[model samples]
Target: MLATPPDFDVLIVGAGISGIGMAAHLEMMCPNRSYGIVERRADIGGTWDLFKYPGIRSDSDMHTLGFVFEPWKHEKSIADGPAILDYLNRIADERGIRDHIRFGHKVVLADFRPDEARWHVTVELEDGERKLLTANFLYLGSGYYDYDDPYDAGFDFSEFEGQVIHPQFWPEDLDYTGKKVVVVGSGATAVTIVPSMAEKAAHVTMLQRTPTWMFSRPARDAIANFLRKILPEKVAYAITRFKNIRMQDFTFKTARDKPQKVKDALHKRISKTMGNDFDLKDFTPPYNPWEQRLCLVPDDDLFESIKAKKASVVTGHIDKFEAGGVRLKSGELLEANIIVTATGLSLAIAGKIDLRMAGEPVKFDERFYYKGVMFSNLPNLAVVFGYLNASWTLRADINSEFVCRVLNQMEANGSDLATPVLTPEAEAQLEEDDLFDFSSGYIQRGKHIMPKSATAYPWRLNQEYLYDRKVMRKGDILDGVLTFTKAGANAQSPDEQLEAAE
Candidate 1:
């Protein structure tokens, strides 16, 4: 029998924003390297397409959230779900990138063969057929949320006669117009729906156990609009992108450094906006800002809705679900015709794919991450997970460019494998904690299975975007931290080969 060639040089496990961006970057920098995107969903947009809840939009503005290579031409900085999906589709279609995507391929197994320096991937198609693909490198651009299972919040939905809806699987014909609505949770999803539903619903109430940090900004970027009219399109985008990034970074840094000052400033804004009638305590979060992702309200829509008497906020524990509505622990009942559980997402790591090396199973929990991208001692793979504190695409963009640099470096050095080996000293100094460092329910719920971050650089989950950009931009492939092994190095064991990466 004739020998067969590997499917592609690089296998990207998602066709979402990061995957598409990865494809674009690969084509731009390493044209000779062949790659294909395998997406489980039939469509292009990942989360944007997956979610159909009313009032769904981005918490982060489009200037920094948009891809570095592409300019978001839309007027709204906080665009709706459909607009974002459309933007993603437009990039894929216009760039002719859709041709390389293999839809309906769900990766179930990814095993690294150290002997051949390749990955043997097992994919399951929608039609129930299983197939195998081989590649020199694997890139996980698949977003982290679990599609099949959203967080349940442990509510007895059977007791409630009212309509209970999860944001991920919003019903097509469930009309909430002229109905009393209560949105559960105080995160981005709940806030987004509270304002949008307030426009149609008779009255909407946001129910939360604790308050969340909220910030308001105009939906449209005045400077960006003015710049577009005067400056070149790309130039305007660059300026706007830089300005937003710097401002966002400053706010986050200030919060971390002088939390009490930031807290006071936030109280001032809330007090000024809501006036004396509204209780400011209901808006004040207990924890310091940036401990969890802050909620963004565009153009003060949520506040305006509250001011117009279209919506209200209720902070209490749910005693139980009654036939009429949710009963609070204080013996008060809030009547609601529709209950929206904007609860939270169920976070899963590595897409539940059983990753192995040389037939030996790999346990992610036992290892610390390498530069927040590659797993410790895992060879030839990188997972792109962005910062919760910043626009996800910021890290994704830098990650794609970083991958391209690694591939080019490998080709130049005639190397076939690159792995992040935990040195004896690094291992001794390793500190095991939650990878996210977040207090959100989703992060708390999934911390056990998540990987750990070390106490030092090239191992810690660097949450700061500007710092990460500078670090990853250096493209130090042989920084003595990440290891690379040569092709057909049979004389050495896998452990020895990994240490010989440089």
Candidate 2:
């Protein structure tokens, strides 16, 4: 049965950071317009609220990960899960965004009608009832990962008698205390889970398919703390943000330019910290640094766990699962009371929502990205993607500003819809192979969904903060691909014409 539909000017899917941020921008720009945010979970904070794995925290620094309009005031630069969730909840409550969010409402499908210039969205309520809503604009912020379970390759777990758990679907009641635990995968989740579980488990073994580059640093920023006491809070935040951004920029540049030196330095640091307790080959990555994400070790916790003989890392492929254990391809068997498959997530384009325009299917795989925002020849649509080299919020902020500029211009020019039309030559130049090279699951699934770029920065990815600000925020919005349609001569206003020229 279908329930009555709700009408709104804008309907945003997912109440995560991105969705919430988008709603905030809309409210600020068009206060008179009615807007609603839909979330599947009973609460907000999307991933943060769902993921309850031990040692769950942000992989990046909190200062950069946070929203630009709302600065994270916590003293810890690298915040844990609870702190991050608290920050997100605070932002929603303080901004009065909680009321606008309809929790337990999960959008299943969305279709765009070109004639109406609106999206018909169907959502499934908690009570197993379906409903439809129409909105002028549709924003997807569901993110790339599958929240239900870790997308492990088909391994029959039914045969294994031991308890099996995926970090994405962690059970709160199950106790791991005094139990031999095995955590699989080499990504951030595996790195976090092993150390935390080591504290309670009888023994924790990290089984990885490949080694990843890992670096350890202090989580607390002592200098920033001192500055907070000496200077104003805003000034202190600015100083900390600048220092972290510059340092990250320098580190990424140096690693990219002088690969061998950085790799050697990293190898030496890890070897020195571990001594003769563990083999160096098992911990070192085969590729150069920054080829994949470098794992951050807060306060040397992972290394300390290794030194304490509480954790051990094994590098090999899994053959199959045996009763009460995991069998490695190397003919070695690891017995465990519990298995934690921290494998990885599955990625989906536009949150895997089906998109249509003018009764024709808009294949994301066949489209070329324009400035990493809109697909070629796509109308009334834009995607918010962040920089690979810099903070995700840095690019998202610019994207929001760009959206606002486009909307303001369209209203002033009497334009009913604006679309990006790429030339044939431009479309032909795009290569599919360049789109995905990383080992991460999100990048793999995104290969067919995102734009392929040749270089890392300024072209494929512009990480320079100032450069992006000038090009994306203040640059000509109507320059190349954008095409606007006038509603009617009498419908056009003076403000519309002036905005079009600007």
Candidate 1, residue 360: Cα displacement in angstroms equals 2.5
Model 1 lDDT, residue 374, Cα: 84
Tens-place lDDT per residue, model 2, 76-108, is 878888998898889888888889999898887
**Maximum-TM-score candidate:** 1
lDDT (10s digit) by residue, model 1, range 1-502: 1145568889998888889989988988999998999999998888887888888899999998899999999999888888888888998988878999999999999998876778999999999999999999999998887888999888987788889999999997988989999999999999999989999999999999999988888899999999999999999999999999999899999999999898888777766677867687778888999888889888889999999999999899999999989999999899999999999999888878888988888888877877778888788998888888899999889999988888998888667787777767758876664577788999899888878787678887788899888888875778886766664554454446535544
Clashing pairs in 2: 412-496, 413-496
Give the TM-score comparing model 1 with the true structure, all chains together.
0.96
State the displacement of the C-alpha of residue 41, model 2, in Å, after optimal TM-score superposition: 1.5
Q: What are the C-alpha RMSDs, in order, of all predicted structures?
A: 2.2, 4.3
TM-score of 2: 0.89
Among all windows of 10 consecutive residues in model 2, the one with the lowest summed lDDT is 486-495
Assess each prediction's global lDDT (C-alpha) against the native: 0.87, 0.74
